[model samples]
Target: MSYKTIVVHLDTSARAQARLHLAIEIAKRHGAFLQGVFAVFAPNPRSFVVMAGTAEYYEEHETVRHEEHGALERLFEAELSRAHVDGEWIDETGNADDELPKYARRADLLIIGQDDPADPESFVADHFPENMVMSAGRPVLVVPYAGSFAHIGRRVMVAWDGSREATRAVHDALPLLKQSEQTTVVTISAAHGNVPGARPPGADIAATLTRHGVKVTTLDLPAAKDVATGEMLLARIDDIGADLVVMGGYGHTRWQELILGGVTRTMLSSMTVPVLMSH
Candidate 1:
């Protein structure tokens, strides 16, 4: 399957442009229809004190929101038009944590910025990326908040394990993998949860990807002393000069709270490149 429809999250964050740039590139590459979903944090008027000046406070807040919304819409339109990519803009004012996933579910892929706590403009909800990865049934490509990624999916790395989540991620990333110049499937002993005994770790997946026209190879990571699997994966990506990583987003929701797996948390916080994750 291909990415026929792609949804991208847009806001006033510093990395919003970077996210949009990559999204447009991906859309152009796949000849896909892009949807730019604009959703940002807005404080509820009821949360403010019921005072004489409350009306003024509410009015000013709306005015700023409208200005920013219009600006972002203009920018999105201009970029898409210049790139010759077909797309539409969607302005959303609801809670992002609940609303973004609804849009994501209807698209073939969702592109979003990595959570940057220091960037006050990007604060929609706590653990926003984590929540989206777990909640959005589609694949989620999370762009890093600090870097400029002009392109991606050239040299790809897949974090392979034998779990259902990992299997789903591999299938979800098949389109990208087939287009990548080179793809490496790395199996970290600590991260390979319940690998099938029928064949060696990463072998079956490598063979399947090869059949799908992906330039695929497998690597079994050597045991490391006191090194976390996430750290190892990051180092390997850098060493191989990979532009993108595909992996499973391991997490579960509990009472509306997300409890991310250890490796997933580490990658979300410290990833150096874009990651395409599926749950």
Candidate 2:
């Protein structure tokens, strides 16, 4: 199966253009319709305590935001025209955490940016990426804030643990896996244990991918109790030169991930390559 419609989140952040470029490329590759949804952090003036000049401040903020939004739409339309991509632009004014997930549900895939703590403009909402991963009801591709990725689906790494979430992620990522030059399933054996009937931890999934015409391999890594599985996966991704990573997101609740630590949370914080995640 291929992506028929892809939704991308755009904002005032510097990296938004990079995300748009990548989304256009993906749309071009898959011959899919692209939707650029402009959703940023816009706090409602009504939510604040009534004070003198509050209305004036709110009005000024909105004026600036609208101008910037228009500029971004022009850029998005220009890129779509230049690439000959079928697409549309959507202007949203609300909490990003709420609006993006709504848009994502109607698309085959959602492309978004990883949170950049150093850039205030990237703060569209609290834990935006994590929320989207859990609530989008579709696969979310998160592009790193610090890098330039001109290509994806070339070399892929799938973080496998054999849970329902992992199964869903693998299935959601099938389109890209079929196009990948090489795909590897990295299993954290000591931490997650083995799949029910597979001799090796990742054998079953690897075989399943093989059936779908994916050039696949498996790697079983033993992790100690004190070591973080996410760190291990990141190192292996670099060693293998993977450009895209597919994995389950927040197998546990967000609270559990925050308290006990989790691969999904870690990758969201420190991924070097683009990550496609599903909950």
Off by over 4 Å in 2: 46-63, 195-198, 251-261
TM-score of 2: 0.90
Which pairs of residues collide in candidate 2?
A: none
lDDT of 1 by residue, 144-211 (tens): 99877999999999998777888888999998999999999998764544443435588899999999
Q: What is the C-alpha lDDT of each candidate?
A: 0.89, 0.89
**What is the lDDT, from 0 to 100, of the residue 220 in candidate 1?**
80
Clash number for each model:
0, 0
- Candidate 1, residue 178: the lDDT equals 90
Give a tens-digit lDDT track for model 2, residues 92-158: 8777777788888989999999999898889887778888888899999999999899889999999
Q: Name model 1 segments beyond 4 Å from true.
A: 50-62, 193-200
